[model samples]
Every structure is written in C-alpha cells, then in structure tokens.
Target: MAGGRQISENKKGLPRRWRFMHGAYFYSVPPGQECMWDGKKTFHLGRGLPEAFRKWAARMEQPGKIHTVSDLLERYLLEVIPKKAPKTQIENARHVRSLMAAFGSAHLYEIRPRDIYRYVDARSAKTAARREIEVLSHAFTKAIEWGLIDNHPFKGQIRLEGETPRDRYVEDWEVIEALSLSAPQKRGRRQGPAGLYQAEAPDRPFTWGYASPAAGCEFPGRWHSGAVS
Candidate 1:
C-alpha cells in the first residue's frame, strides 16, 4: 500500500475506498480487488469485477486478438451464408463485400453510425443502399451475439426510403393490345399479353383488373391506355 494514495486529501469528495493514481480514479474492493473507475459514475471494480478483470487481462495478454469488421464479415460469410437460400446468399455476399471494402480494416467497436451513414450516402441507389445497411445491421447483431462486439452502430439509425405501391389498374383491352404488338421470339414460344394477363390474374378475377397496368406495356405511352381516369 506504499503507492496507495489516500482519497481524503482529494477535494473531489470521492469515497475513501476510491484512490486517484496516474490521472484515473480506482476503487479498492475488499479481498484485494482494484477496479478502474470510468469516471462516468459506474464502478467496474465492484461486484462481479473479477470475471471482467480476467477477460480484460486475457485480452491484454493477446493484444492482437481484437475483432475487426473484416473478421466479422468473414465469420458471417462462412457461418451464416450457407444457411440462407442461394439467391439470398448471393445478395448478402455482394452487400458484405461492399461493407468490407469500406470498413474492413476498422475494428468492430470503432465503427459508428456516421460511418454507416457515409456509406449509405455514397451509394447511388437508395434501395440497394438500404439493403446493404440492413445486411450490415444483421451481421452486427450476429457479432454481438457471438461476443465479438458490444453494440450495433446501425441499430435505429438506418432509415430506408418509403416504397410507393403501384395503384394503376390494367384493363383487359390494354393487355391485349400490348401483347399483340410484342413479336414472338424465334427460339421459343412467347408469352402474349393474354397469356401474361392470364398468368398474373390466376389468383383473382380479371374483372377487378391487375394492379400493375404497366406489366404488359413495354412501350412508353402504353401504360396510359388503361388509365383509371
């Protein structure tokens, strides 16, 4: 206890158990537990500090074992991607690659909401950017569950643009007209407007019409032919 400075001499009014040393306050626990105070009113050296101290000590011993964004992405790709559908795997892989290119060198804990927002802003496609952030958010959640990181940077921060649903209705005649203009391909039988309309309207009666009037109309002005107005 030679180097143990007394708390009474300090004007800050900290408890006697707390001692200031090397510009930080440390609380001394019974049975030889010394925990560093984060100066935010939280005591890390109090109850259950031994386990935390042990983890800290272990981390100190290794030093280079800190997980980075690239590491998390690699683990996610290896462990989680295989469980998803083939199409989903491809899509998620693309998103992860984009994320890795940006923050792969940064530590998982160092990434913040601003960095994610920057990435979102850099992308030209709003929907694709949203999807990329969504994938990154899921990966960060998995990283939390895996004990790689403590929190998600993108949680509650990502805002995707609203998608407007198409309300235009396609009349039967418009579908017929559009299909009539489409020439059949030489290699295979083409699905005409009637055939396409039939395929799209199997679940509902055609009287109510299809919600997407532009489905059969490839021409620029064809969508207006069946306008509800």
Candidate 2:
C-alpha cells in the first residue's frame, strides 16, 4: 500500500535506487523503510558500485517502520546525526530541536506545505528558518522512504528568501597591490629577513611564521591592522 511515485526503470545508467557521488556508491532506501536501516535515508555502500549492489539487494529484502514526526526526529537525532560531519552534526541537532518544537507531536502524513510556509513566515531569522526547513524537508524525504508517509508535503514548494551575500569582496589585484606596497617598506627596515618573505606571506602567516624569520617581526599585527604602505 505504498504511495507516491512508482518505482521506474533506471534511465540514469546506474541501477535503480543506486547513486554514485564523491567516489562512493549509495543505495536510496525504498519508500517507507528507512527505520529498517537504522534511519539512514541512503546507505553508503563503498567506492565500487557493482559490489555494493549485492549489499543493497540483501538489505532490500527487509523493511521496518515508525510512528510520529517526533518519532522521526528522535530516530534522526539518534541514528543520523552521529554519521554526519562534526559541523553538520551540530547544525542538524539545532535544526531538529527547532522542528521538534513545531511538529514533534504531529503525524507524519498530517504535515502540509502550507504548514511549512507558515513556519517560514513566522520565523524571525529567514536564513536560519531556511536551514531548519531544509532539515525538515529531508526528514519528510526519509519518512517517504521509510513508508511512514506516501507523499512529501513541502519538498520543493517552500522558498524562504535569505539574506544576499555582500557584494564588496576584496579583489585579487587589490590584495597584490597591498602586498606590493608593504613589501618595499618592510625590506627597507629589515633587509635580509624581509627579502626572504614573499608576496604570499600575508595570506599564510602561521605557515610562513615557522618557515621564515620575518614572521617573528611585528608584520603579522601590522598586516592584520590593514597597514599596507
């Protein structure tokens, strides 16, 4: 009694439910069965895709289940968060906590796109809201895979407009000119040590610090203070 898109033939050249990325093979869980795989939305099957297919086939024979949005959140916090990168694990945990406050007690299928939009609109931090919704959307995706729900309510529909990136990034030529202007002055003060320091010294202080004696000079503080010439 599974719902949503039917399983189709693999036109992407790889096997059905299988994906290759960053030099590893991944198996997308069957809709409504992620709980069986300990809440992993996709199983990392290793670098060699062909051999990984056998592992995928064996895991596909078994299926598992879940209860509510909170149930999903718990499982994700327990099973999924530990597997992510250190920074991402912290971010996802915060996102999950925010989501739990809003949708924890609700049933998986009961969530709608409108509910998500309302959440987005109500949140004061648009960028943070967008990130939290991304986590929520991914949870719904896992819900569909685990067979907890037949359809994702807010997968691609909600758009939380975040702050734009600042346009005033420093140019490479500006950096080169700054370095050029500072170099001769440094050489004038300390001839031998300053001559050893290159234009790239300002970019990598710690590395250059151990590598060159000039790094011991007050150049680190002077450069950081934006004293060019």
Score residue 168 of candidate 1 by CA lDDT.
55
Query: Could you list the CA RMSD of all candidates, in the order they appear?
Result: 24.1, 23.2
Over 4 Å off in model 2, which ranges? 1-65, 163-229
Q: What is candidate 1's lDDT per residue for 42-152, written digit by digit as tens? A: 234322222323323332222235477777776666566545554455566667766666666676766655455445444556576666676777777777677777656
- Identify the candidate with maximal TM-score: 2
Per-candidate TM-scores read: 0.42, 0.43
In Å, residue 76's CA in model 1 sits off its true spot by 0.2
Q: What is each predicted model's overall lDDT from 0 to 1?
A: 0.47, 0.54
> What residue runs in model 1 are displaced by over 4 Å at the alpha carbon?
1-66, 162-229
